[model samples]
Target: MSKRWIGLVVVLWVTACSPIDPKLKQYLVEGERLYVLHCSNCHQRDGQGLRRVYPPLAGSDYLKENLPRVICSMKYGLQGEIIVNGIMYNQAMPGVPSLTELELAEIATYLYNSWGTQTGLIDARRIGPLLDSCARPRPRR
Candidate 1:
């Protein structure tokens, strides 16, 4: 094969492998709305949480590494210390137990794609099973 043909093939392959999903825009819009309603109060509109209190989602290291934990925490709440971008946060974050799987997926998709991360759509189909296995918080002593 010629160099030009090889280059064209490579470009075609890359494009085919990364086609933008049609539902992404819809998901992002819904997610942003839901985040404003359900999460912005604490996490803030820009995802910059209050100083030394609520953890910021903007460029959060915790979010990058803890997708499962984040998912579970959304529905079940979170307690104890968690490191976000090397900062130690020990505050208790209450979850939204009422959010459905689709809602959670939308929110996840927004957060993961917004700020600095680009994790794309977090499908509700992928969310349901993970939520089923969420680890419940222990009762306070």
Candidate 2:
């Protein structure tokens, strides 16, 4: 094969491998909106929260490794010890159960995706189960 053909093949291969999902993009946009309405005040518009009161979401380890826990907290709020960035905080994370399941999912997706490396969507599929589990905890976390 000619060098020109090889270059064309490489370009096509790259394009095919990294197809951006339109739905995923759409969810991200909506998630931003959800974050604003529900989380911005405490976490701030830039995901930076008030000192000792709210928790920063930017570069948050809890947001990444403990994704499910984040979802649980969002669904039912936190009442005990919590860490944000490198700081430890103990505050009442007010519940937002009034938010629809979709809204919760969107916010979850936004926070999860915003931190360091992007993550898979925390959509209705994962959220439905998590919410169900957290809202009425048979065994507390």
Candidate 3:
């Protein structure tokens, strides 16, 4: 094939592979709103968190590794000491138990896709199971 044809095929393939999902876009928009209203207080609008107080969500190793725990924590709250980016943070993060699975998914989608992270869409369907797993009672510190 000619060079121009080869380039055209590459471009077409790239575009086809990465089509934007409208649902994801909606999730992101709603998620931002929810984050600002519910989470941005501690995590901050930039997701930098407070200086050594609230853990920074931006480029957070904890967030990246503990997706299931994060989802659960969103509904069940998190207590005691948790480490993010090798720094230990001891804070009582209250969960918004009223947030529906869709809202949780939207917030998560926004968080994972923002601040130097690109984890794509986190579907609401996947959240239910994660929430269920952490529904049991546990001791708090």
Candidate 4:
């Protein structure tokens, strides 16, 4: 095999080996825009949630540890207690049902990786449609 061919194969392999989901990256970017507009207030310009009223999300265990619950919170709404970064917090986090699965995925993924985390990822878009995906149930008349 030629050296150029080897280079091409290496490039392909790197792209293929990348664990970060392509859509996740897109969502994280979108989530950044949305976070600035919608979430940055409480979550802070950084991922750090408010002291008592909110909670620090940058190094949040909630975003990093409890993946499913975080997904549910974003999908529906969170009312009650949450523990993040080993700190306990009880607050009401309004659901973001308005967010598309892609959007939700992006925000969560972005927040998670933004912190001290170097691995573990959330593809919440893929979690869409699951009953526990979110809380706002479809209303039936």
Candidate 5:
């Protein structure tokens, strides 16, 4: 085989071996945009969050352990105490009730994958039923 054909096969193999799926890439792109619009103000552009007030999403234990709650909290808001990365945060986070289930999934996908977590696409289909089961009303300030 010619050198050009060998190079083409090598490129194809490398591309096939890539871990990032096209669907995951699309989710990540959409999620990043949604995160910027809805979450970045509090979470910060780097996911570091505001000091002491807004909890950091990067490698957050709460997020890892409480995927359902995190999803619910985005739409219904959170008030009370939660521990993240060994630190306790008691601040209230208002939900974006206007966000659709698909939008929430995109945001969740972004949050789960960005910073340090490698969790892939959070599908909108999964989010719909979860949102229905949230049950709790949005907290009153």
Candidate 6:
């Protein structure tokens, strides 16, 4: 191909791909800040949790399978034993009840997108119902 044609093809390829949404970018920035403040203590800034005590969020099978529970845990806290990857973790992660729905979405977005995961934006709209569902008490059978 001619140089001009090659250059044109490259430019078209670049322009054809959409840029990251501005809202997602903003959420990532804010989410990172929130993660640093609330989660970095145990999960670490790298998303690699402390060995044995905290499960690694970087490549967590638990996280991959438990989106609703993970979202609930952010607001209501998580307790008891859980398996992440293949290891068992039993620490009680304290809830940050003060976090708004949007904040939760931001944090979720950051976590899901970072550390080799790419689940995309966890919108605030999606968070509200999940929180409500978790808030309701389950009836005994």
What TM-score fits each model? 0.81, 0.76, 0.84, 0.69, 0.83, 0.85
For residues 85-115, what per-residue lDDT tens digits would candidate 1 score against the true structure?
8888888988898999889999999999998
Runs of candidate 4 exceeding 4 Å displacement: 1-25, 129-141
Error of 6 at 82 (Å): 0.3
- The deviation in Å at residue 5 for candidate 5 is 15
Which scores higher on lDDT, 1 or 6?
6
Off by over 4 Å in 1: 1-20, 138-141
What is candidate 3's lDDT per residue for 22-121, written digit by digit as tens? 8989999999999999999999999999988999999999999998999988887998899899999999999898999999999999999998888999
lDDT of 6 by residue, 44-86 (tens): 8899999899888899999899988998998878888999988
Tens digits of per-residue lDDT, candidate 2, 1-141, equal 999999999999998888777766777899899888878988899887788788788877777677667877776777878776678888788767677777777777778778565876767677777766654544546
Global fold similarity of model 6 (TM-score): 0.85
Candidate No. with top TM-score: 6
| Reference-based lDDT, each prediction | 0.89, 0.77, 0.92, 0.72, 0.87, 0.90
Compare the candidates by lDDT and give the number of the best one: 3
Task: Please say which candidate is ahead in lDDT: 1 or 5.
Answer: 1
Q: Once superposed on the true structure, which residue ranges of model 5 sit more than 4 Å away at CA?
A: 1-13, 16-19, 138-141
TM-score of 1: 0.81
Ranking by lDDT: 3, 6, 1, 5, 2, 4
The CA root-mean-square deviation of candidate 1, after full C-alpha superposition on the true structure, stands at 5.5
Clashing pairs in 2: none
lDDT by residue (1-141, candidate 5, tens digit) is 999999999999999998878878888898899899988998899999888889999978888998889999998898899888888889899889898988888889989988877887889899988877776883459
Candidate 3 Cα outliers beyond 4 Å, as residue runs: 1-18, 135-141
Candidate with better TM-score, 2 vs 3: 3
